[model samples]
Target: MKQTNYYLFDWMDFDESLSKDESLWKAYTSTEVKAVDGDIHITVPYQKQVLQEDMLADTDVPQRDYILILRAYGDSIVRMFTSMVDDEMKDTGSYMLELDKALTHKPLSVEFADNVYTIKDNDGRTRARIDITPYNTEWWSDLQPGPQPTIHLTVYPDGNLAKGVELSDDHFSPPRYDALPIGFCLTEGKPDRATVSFKCEADECFVGTGERFRKMDLSGQTFYLKNQDGQGVNNRRAYKNIPFYMSSRMYGVFYHTSDYCRLSLADHSSRSVQFRNDRATIDTFIIGGETPERILFHYRQLTGFPPMLPIWSFGIWMSRMTYFSADEVDEICDRLRAEHYPCDVIHLDTGWFRTDWLCEWKFNPERFPNPERFLKRLSDNGYKVSLWQLPYVANGAEQIEETKANKYISTPTGGWENAAGTSGASNFSTLDYAGTIDFTSEKATEWYKGLLKNLLDMGVKCIKTDFGENIHMDATYESMTPEQLNNIYSLLYQKAAYEVTKDVTGDGIVWARAAWAGCQRYPLHWGGDSESSWAGLAGSLKGGLHFGLSGFAFWSHDVPGFHSEPDFMNSVIDPKVYMRWTQFGVFSSHMRYHGSHKREPWYYPTIAEDIKKWWRLRYRLLPYIIEESRIATESGWPMIQALLMHHPEDKTVWHIDDEYYFGRKFLVCPVMNGNDRRDIYLPEGEWVNFFTGEHFEGGKWYRNVEVPLDEMPVFCRPGTEIKVYDEKVDSTDDIDWQKVKTLFIE
Candidate 1:
């Protein structure tokens, strides 16, 4: 067994609270407070402690005073900052765009009494409190065994009470008095890390750690916030990682930083949710609300809300790994229209550039002769084009020399062959000797955006921003460390592409694969590469659910799956799996059919008719999808909502992951396998089957219900009305909203 090092954490003593007995941990003692520009600032001098171990003597040296600042936004949100070494605290990345505007909410009541500072609202309810009373260590020498008195911050939301304790009328006390406080960790006499620990109930559940592929509930799990190619949907690593999570305790925490972070949601100790930021300052926004929806509203307000997507962007997109020529794209479009298949966008992936997978921002002259005419012809027929590109320059590629000469590509700190800097210029598969485009530089951003602008001028409606998760974490950038810039690189890259496309074509949409907190403003993002298997389909659903919970409004996954076992050893997807995945895709916020194989419905003749049936249903439900998506963007909710988002009070719904609400009306349960039986749990209402007209009461379990492959378990709430466009059309452009009809279910 590997030995655990307790000293890595500044607060974790060898015997938990044993530091209180020996006074071996240094804590802050508040000295002065000042109010400046609607913010409270405090100076806290460190009270030095004597160390008993010689190994830790170096870290016990005296340090400067810590600066603690607190600001309130309305009644529900409180921003907290603990600064070390006078670091200028700033939002260095694109994480928070409307942070300044969010401070215009109603003022909060602030008070400090006997070393405890509290902030309340007009209702005289405590929203946040900071307890900094120094502890009398002698009392903990076996005379009094209680929680140690250290500086800590706690946010109070409505209906939060201590477990196994009831409130009395005389004197009110908060529950769970035995959790650690927020503080900094000293390394070699300098604070190098900041940690925030919150009290956790035994039944407390957490969600939304950014596109997680595991179980729905994030209880007893530790996650790292670093963007990496998830490779497959079955592991912990993901392309999108956000340092934000909401608890069933009716509160959420957004650790505001671009650096690497570690979140332990009661995985190390069952009593606390520990968050560690690898930086000198602990800057966070502690949001309290009455429900998870309210919490998400504040989170999106602090960050930016997702912009409304173009109406055509909601239509079905058809794509594959590589469409090698203009003839291939033409053939697919022709076949879809001939078969009366409804699709609005045709995406050309990897093969639009001069060389396949080598992106120089130019269409292949030989393969795509008269590109402007071709794009115009496609546009005339009510079809849009989306091209794929990444922010990487191959060594022998045409544009590498120009980019390197102009310093648009990121190299080593001093040069490409600097000492211990070979990883920055390493080869990536067939794209040998690659270099990452530095989005941090303003000149480079315009240069790259110029390339994308030219494509949009030729009628490319959208740009697929891909492969941003592979940035070297140790490379140097324009003004920030790689640790602070790698995860946010996804945001910068996609923002540039989305803005340029919207500027030229009037549609701000990108088929992005990587994301951080504020990437939702870019309109749409999709799940990364997934394997062609049953587990892959299940994992993709879980990923999308968690992504929505993380404050994203639009999300989609590759239909069926992206690749197969043994690296595309079998090109053909299983027919049943294709049919089942097609059912899942129709109800998504945006639908796209893409994989290693041909994703056209005609490929599987046995199930071709069934595939067409589901596709038509998607068109019929387009009216509901558009309204729900608009509501989601405005209300800061996800179009594809997990059951827990609406039923957080129900303990049974916390563990149910496979079931979800497609919109306000329909409950979609995807069939993942060939099995004819599955269990479905409905929460607290009457549900009517959308297909079979069967009714089932909620608040109970229905076990082993028989279902056929042709039908999924789709149910709608009682007395729900859904608008449907029942007219036959080959694309969304041909449908008129005035001809739509409504279906009322009861």
Candidate 2:
């Protein structure tokens, strides 16, 4: 492996033909090399390197592209290939690349055609590219050299370096290679179109690289690459981020990318996996699968997968900008329940904590007396609690002191420093999870975990894991650099809290606001702060649908608007908005009523009756939603699916972002506007209106339908079964499925 201070590059020794100079392929200065993994690290010094014109091939062939192949260690090797088309080697063409187990005796192929070159795997899958046109390099000798060889590639005006390979003679290859960093293994095999299989010991499972909807454990089951995020365990984020993962089954896959991704298992451990990216190579890996899938699955999964949320979590969640006193909170919940309005979870905004220290995690005794009893009372009434919290630690927080004393927090320079300032906006004072807690250091993770444990013991059921997405890249960590930690900060923080919650309560939930590629492993993710207009609601749904498409499963948003006027700006709570949003929320894997303003039905009495009706509708639909959640937990399918997921082949569905498919059955067309009528499109399948039992033809658009204030457009695909429950129930566990009615769409 080529080892640099920051990255580990896989290395390999290939035939002389693959190198610029046959005899000096392994020479240090001629081809500077570093061992990151088994991957060969090669850097070319600019002035010292020479390219023999004769040795350069005129690869441009019309109607065909070329693939450039380099072989490293059969497994865990990282390979990169660039192409030059035509006699004028100035313009480098598109190239394909792959890294994985090496093949025996098979030649890697590169195709050149129409002034474009294509790179493919042993099986011929295109990976990455450098597009070059003949016009741009009419005269090859016209190019000037500075310190490196000028290989012509596409250049973007936005300062993006594209379409070319930078050549330098400063090659520094390390003499001896070492194994990959922690939790990795090396294997040997060839790259071929044929499926490759490896033996995994019994109980070994796979995790990482793909967007999954369940907890970070995949043992005794198989998974494929498909992006989806819904309101369930597997559905947490709006989109999938990382295309790579390490398998606890001993090996892992890192699909090289910049495009759509896919992963399929041939069988448990005795299987072949494939990675596909738009302009990148098909990179695959194989390793010894010996440990239980649970351990490796979670290990890699935790690296990507977030934790599951708490169950009391499934209740009605009410939120608004501020709820100052415990009495106000009590009054809101009491009014909702007293008025027979369904409600469960109560959210307290930034005001619940000490005003002097904005996110101290300490309840203000003045406003909230007898915190324990107050929470117990809410719990007794079937209400669960969620408190808003960020990664930032308050300036005077006792926890900050403890964190510093234990060396569990990040230091600005060399000592304890406040990460969250009292200014209320973002502060550099926030604890950098990537830097603060030395997760690699056993002591740090333990110290941080203890703080969360105390909260779990305090009856805190859910934590809003917020603001991790905006981590500053300038911060430093004693263990990990800021850049490396920036991407995984959310994962690390969520994992730490999740671990503690699980230890104390067996299972816990975190409603994280910001995330990176693998943040989906966490149970619930909400859209970032939004406004209270129709556009905001529409944006919320679009964000949710987009996130689902990206690979997040369970997503929630503040009801109405998190920062909108309580009266909805004199527009009144448009029943169309409430009704449509409710329908969408009910079909979601998890539903909650939240916003910056009070979202309780009684708050908007004009729509209270209709809101109650929809609340009942949601309660009745719990069985179906729950079952969908279970299915999502088992399979990677999201509970809230985009229409394209159901009709992938339908070009129309691909651009239909305004609507989404709720699970496999319901098609929800939310009213993004305040208009009473909506235009809805039905894909090429018979659809039945849920409320009216009206059937609509597939593959067409319908307009001018007078939607009642109490209804949103909901269509159920023909031949699907829907389960319903009583609206009065407090918890899903007590609902009798047998007593619930099942409706057939047809």
How close is every model to the real structure, measured as TM-score? 0.90, 0.63
The TM-score, computed over Cα atoms with residue i paired to residue i, of candidate 2 is 0.63
- lDDT for each residue of candidate 1 in 285-326, tens digit (9 for 90 to 100): 777777777888888888888988888888889998778888
Which lDDT tens digits does candidate 2 get at residues 283-344?
Answer: 33222122222222322322233333444465567776568878988888787777766666
Report the poorest 10 consecutive residues by lDDT, candidate 2.
Answer: 177-186
Off by over 4 Å in 1: 1-26, 29-34, 45-64, 89-95, 100-116, 121-125, 131-149, 157-180, 417-428, 567-571
Whole-model lDDT values for every prediction: 0.76, 0.49
Best-fitting candidate, measured by lDDT? 1
Give candidate 2's whole-model lDDT.
0.49
- After TM-score superposition, what is the CA distance of residue 102 in candidate 2 from its true location, in Å? 20
